[model samples]
Target: MTTYAVQRSLPGITMEQLAAAQAAAIEASKEASEQGSPVTYIRSNFYPADQRCTCLFEADSKESVEKVNRAASIPFDRVEEVLDIPPMQH
Candidate 1:
């Protein structure tokens, strides 16, 4: 599986709405996996200042990630493959 980033511009979004969107994304990912597409929601970062949200997912292809977001009724600017580098362990 490859890591992908889903970029979204959510202007005027509230905390409650953000939580709901996250939940929807999770559920959508589970449903996709069950259907054999196999997408996993890793994490998300929300920037309140710019009203931007970037969500990370592990999936076979970018289409799989896009499908999940569409199924969840989430609007996104774009979906692209990304490199995920973790910090070195102490």
Candidate 2:
């Protein structure tokens, strides 16, 4: 499997909502890291209401990363899949 940076955009999402979602994400990351794979989920962007909320996650696949967003119940505009593969890996 390869590493992927999953970018999720949250639309019309407020700071409070983002805060709550972020709390849950932090907890989830702790749990998942303890369980397996040791993934990192990061929340970026200061103004979410005006701009889209961003999250960067390192996971093996898009499906797994999307599952994290869905499980967090965070309202998102879009989820971008960016695979991180190097020539050396091939």
Best by lDDT: 1
Candidate maximizing TM-score: 1
Clash count for each candidate, listed in order shown:
0, 0
Residue 59 local lDDT, model 2: 64
Clashing pairs in 2: none
Runs in model 2 lying further than 4 Å from the true structure: 1-12, 48-51, 83-90
lDDT of 1 by residue, 1-90 (tens): 999999999999999999999999999999999999999999999999999999999999999999999999999999999999999999
- RMSD per candidate (Å) reads 0.8, 5.1
* Candidate 2 steric clashes: 0
Q: For residues 35-60, what per-residue lDDT tens digits would candidate 2 score against the true structure?
A: 77465675455454456556667666
lDDT of 1 at 70: 99
